[model samples]
Target chain A: MEMFVHDETPTAAVDQREQVVSALAGSVRDLVDATIRSTVADEELLAVRAGVDALVARLRTEQRPGPAGVRYNSEGRSWSWGNAVVGHGNAIAPPLAIDHDTERGRSRAEVVLGAAYEGPPGMVHGGVSALLLDQIMGETASGFKRLTMTGTLTLRYRRPLPLGPVALECWIASEAGRKVTVEASIGNADGVAVEATGLFLVPRWAPLAADEQPEGWRRSAEG
Target chain B: MEMFVHDETPTAAVDQREQVVSALAGSVRDLVDATIRSTVADEELLAVRAGVDALVARLRTEQRPGPAGVRYNSEGRSWSWGNAVVGHGNAIAPPLAIDHDTERGRSRAEVVLGAAYEGPPGMVHGGVSALLLDQIMGETASGFKRLTMTGTLTLRYRRPLPLGPVALECWIASEAGRKVTVEASIGNADGVAVEATGLFLVPRWAPLAADEQPEGWRRSAEG
Candidate 1:
């Protein structure tokens, strides 16, 4: 069973669909933020709920039987629209745009968490910070050239991260055969908030020279 | 800087709003699932987007300036409607109905993992598991009697948890001074998939004898 599959969908078609679905996802993100902060009267909320249900029914008219797994075309273009962290169609995900410098084994993203991602008052949830670091560090280890699965993740809560703009960075600390050690952190101008050290492993079944087809393994930080 | 506050919203009013808002969140969750698997034409997607935008505008007519913070009433009814793990108003939060037995120092929740939470093909995202464990363990440590913040969390992924029904449980392993040690896990009939150990701390600023008013600190696993 190949971890990455060639689904035969052309890159252009995938891009077009992504644009439309991403626009919808963006609106849903706004809806979530608004919903969290809305103090409207019950009557207004009920009316809006009805409207949302109607939209949902309309969209359900056409559907796929299961989740959108990561897919790549024969031309080597890949996309993961259902990913928990970077899926374009996932409103739950903070809009994270990672910049991967494969040569330096580093990856970074800047995001502003809002109401939906809150844990404590005016602060980003510790778990949310872990979620972001895991995704970024996993990507850093994979480098889009090989498949990597998280083995162990350890986090230290150095300080509270406020609910606003924050930066995340991860780098390859070391590697031993199939095991890659990654160090990551999430913070803002004040310094690191949550620091993480993760061990990611390239499964034994993966091809040894998968790097020759790096594009096929790309997982949508650039999608 | 009190972590738990008596916001003065009447319990009855809070319950009524929770019912209405929870219904909306349920609908939104279904919408997310459908969106992920949808293979609809671009024209249809665009139309759905427009309908969604209108609904969002309707909801935004009257809104709070910021995120929803945890609040409680004089009657000691507490609600965290925006919590990432247990918020009734948060569509992104899985429907986690936690059963907390304070006397036993244990907390458990049963949830069904779905498409939107996917990471590896058909499997639950690693970070999502961490998020759930952190919340459940934190609640177990607090026992709704004292304020506890996550100090450190370490996770080991034993196996991939599939996207379906899963169970989570946490217990207070030990305690030393203001620090509490908690052990938690997420698994199914096959046994544990992920195991975690977390350190929870009662900040120096929190008053002692908080157990006198446990209800005042109760958060929304029971909302």
Candidate 2:
């Protein structure tokens, strides 16, 4: 894929940039899974780390002081490159590309877990499950145009989730003043193994008026 | 303090061994707090790690394979040295020593987070809060005599928890077949900052006969 930098004016160039970011994010996600499941020797592991460090150095030649926060363009294109959930540059996140069904008030994503996420034998780590759930639930609560923080999360592991491809589905269960409830689940091709319910809060301190177009706050909140 | 090896005789040694283990656990807990809050330089960090590695080597001179599981004696004394909540030899655990009051169905622990636990500026990491709460709520659900696994946990951070000394309290709210509910909170001495609720399940597959002797299952469940 060709890389396109963001431009001063919103145009097809911006959309192309987003596509490149998405493609890069997908590759990074693949790297994560490979790192986890690699049977490579310790020497190889150290060598790989060095290679990654060099790549990071190259990126640092021109970069911001801190993480990439959410950003959006006038054309309504939003991007988050440092997000733990969907960051295009974060290798730790699964290759999860969430598809928001705005009309249905739901979202779904599919990803595979490999060695890096393993906890017991061949199963995914319990904490990894929680991390994925948090992001998806948080997004469900926000519904693509609002802001929410995870106020609370509940999870139940009905069975051990195998290290393989899985599907995650989430939907807004209910919404109240500053509080949105979300329900989500993760399952293998065969059946569901884990289920979650979460309460997300738009802190009383944050702006409640979705109509108000604040700058950084609105950008971060929307993405 | 002198470390005393357990005696082969079952009768007199049980209580004596328990006392020694408890004292050692206390010292280990202190070490955790010190490690967190220490302003020691990088050289000191390396030296400390080396010292710890040597100690581990000495201990491993004669040992079994894999991680330690809960152990008990014929005299009915039980110990768990690999527990995430109350392990005696685990340096990863935060400095937490929970006190259980059976009569009141309550439990409390005090801890201080430091550089190692920091997430946003001076605030404790969100995952660290979840970890600490999981232990307390799990213990509260177990009531120190029965087994429980965290079936579900929910937390609300009303405000950012500063990385410093804090108090945590948990108590049972209700119970229903194989499920115990716990309510807990963490805060600075002045007031509450985070509150949590948990639903702990005594897996249906686990033995439910509380009337059984020895209580190995119960001891393992507290984590």
Candidate 3:
């Protein structure tokens, strides 16, 4: 009956299954990227299409009828792989992994932008940068305890971020009432290419965490 | 010597190929959604992976080593299928298509959100809504006559948008020198779910279009 104690499954077992599923999903994403850039002839393309469809049906021999909504167990392990940014099943997401330091309210991410994220020429899609920034910044603000929505975001693309590895770093700028401000930037070894500032706020609808709660917002360190 | 004459192919031919590629790519997108929700066992998943990879390889038998950049022809027809939002090859992109009306200085889009775009529970991802708005707003500002980049974007997530059909509309709010302000929103039959305002600017490195230019901004009706 306690908050966040819906299931008693050990975090280890949950994570192990998650790892297996994510790895498989990553490969599927790779296939998607390759399919988009291919210039093969129509006859071959149609054959491939039929094959892919059959394979998909095979994979879906058993399936979840609904989306994979967020879930957390008593062990404090939470997984939301359906997320657009970090869902292991998501090939559309950049190869991004962020290291969060709750002590300092800072987060850092390193990712490689490939052909899929390209917007103009070889540069990253401007919105991709925004998507990445909005996510990392929101994570830094929420720290997994409270759900925060991006209120407003301002981005300045000073220079093109090429289709390759990029670095992202951010920190909480300020907090007033329920509003948390975050500043972030993405770049390569050359330097920062895109800079961002965002305002994030906890919605009124969410029940505020009480002070008596034990470890209210701790994201599982393993993930 | 005329402007935007980089290719001599008939616009109709180019568009036909684009249509074909997009249709094939869309099927792959469906497969992607299926893969994420599949509950099949490891043996079946592995077999599916191999089959999908082989299909991808067949499609990529011919390829372009570089990103697909925007191309315009003498007839004022342009295509930028690699664009992050409108890219036909980009399965990660929201199925978004914007119809820009240069005469009215407005842009409209109709889309259907699916499993891939969820952020909170069954609602559309906030970032996805922001991404859609950014692209449509940019197009409204440029009118397909010049290059523009998002300088800053402000979004307010009014309410959760469920996974389903939605509508987007935008118009140029104002233009001052190289800066253009655009207002936009996304909604469904229920009502508007997200609202946005963005500032778009011509990069300093880009040469400004001459004042005497004839038919300064022309968007092809076909997208």
Candidate 4:
């Protein structure tokens, strides 16, 4: 079995399903934020939990055996609805909209993190910043054409990132054989908060030149 | 205005609230997992979304203005219900129950990664591993006493961790003045998967002898 799934589902059908999934995730994200900050009475809270459980059972009546792995159709549309960083259907994922400039070998995203992403009193969690950087760097290194795994990630917390709108940008800094070096950062209006440098390795099993497409891999607009 | 909130709520009251919050979060986590792997028809999925939204509205009836910052009561009971890594009320936080061995200067935890925590196929997300390490190392350095912030965190992905039970352990490797160096790792039944080293720093403004407690800070069982 190939790692990259060649999903034969039609592009139109995939898009429709993505819309439904994204909508559900958005509401769940709101539910999470509300749960953290709620001051409702215990009885009401219990009532809400029961409601949530009922909903879960309804969704589970028909389900996949495992996770929603990255899949691409013949029309070059791909989606990894379960991705931790950018899954459209992942409620816990920060609301990040990344712009991939493959030609420029760079990627950028802007997101407004709310209460759910906090670590320190009013600052973004350090690991959340790392999560964003890793995703963007991985995408930048892979360029949505090849498979690259994060080899090593180093982060320096130069400043505390306040919980609010933040910007992230990453670019391919260098490449040596199968290893790609990527530099990234998460910042706000003041300046950069966290700086990251990552080494991404193209596994030997999926080695392919930049211009050549691997047998089972298909390029997609989303991943 | 203190960074660590001195919540006047009694310890018993806090515990009662925590139980309620935890139950709600537990259900939400299940909802997240079910949504990820659900292959339900579009109509059923849409119906589930409606149900989820109703629950969100009910929970939001009375909500705090912002995130749940770290809080401690007079009884030395602390709770950070919104902490991204270990918040009892946070559905997105991995189910990490850390055992703080202050005497031996070590901390450990074990959790099972479900479908919600995946990244590269069947493997755990690299960022999730970093997240767990950062939280455990932070607690290890602080020892639930003085406050310490992450200054630098470096991680090496030695192997990919599958979606299942994993162990995490961290210890205070060294300490110099206000800086503490901690080493930690996440491993499966097979062996270590990710290795981490972190520098946790005590801000000069809140410095205190390890044996002395800060004026506004109270040691808590959880943070």
Assess each prediction's global lDDT (C-alpha) against the native. 0.80, 0.57, 0.71, 0.82
Question: Which residue pairs collide in model 3, if any?
Answer: A145-A217
Which lDDT tens digits does candidate 4 get at residues A54-163? Answer: 89888888888877777877787877888777887888787567898988899999999888787777678787888778778878888877778788989999988888
DockQ of each: 0.57, 0.06, 0.45, 0.60
Best of the two (2, 3) by TM-score: 3
lDDT of 1 at A168: 98
Question: In candidate 3, which residue ranges exceed 4 Å CA deviation?
Answer: A1-10, A205-223, B1-9, B204-223
RMSD of each: 2.6, 11.2, 4.1, 2.3
**Backbone clashes in each candidate structure, one number apiece?**
0, 1, 1, 1
Q: What is the TM-score of each candidate against the true structure?
A: 0.94, 0.56, 0.88, 0.95
**In model 3, what lDDT does residue B84 have?**
68
Candidate 3 lDDT tens digits, B1-223: 1122266668898788777777767877777787667878767776777777677677667876766655667776766566668887677766577787977889999988776775565667677777788778877887766567777778776776877899999998998888888899998999998888888887675544635233312321111
Candidate 3 lDDT (Cα, whole model)? Answer: 0.71
Q: What is the lDDT of residue A188 in candidate 1?
A: 96
Tens-digit per-residue lDDT, B1-223, candidate 4: 1166878999999999999999999999888888888888888888888888888888888988888888877777788888888889999897588998998889999999887777776667788888888788888888867778788989998877888899998999998988999999999899999999999888887755655765345332222
Best candidate according to DockQ: 4
Clash pairs (backbone) in predicted model 1: none
| iRMSD of all candidate structures | 3.2, 13.9, 4.8, 2.8
Give the 10-residue window scoring lowest on summed lDDT in candidate 3 chain A.
A214-223
Chain B TM-score, one value per candidate, order as shown: 0.93, 0.76, 0.85, 0.94
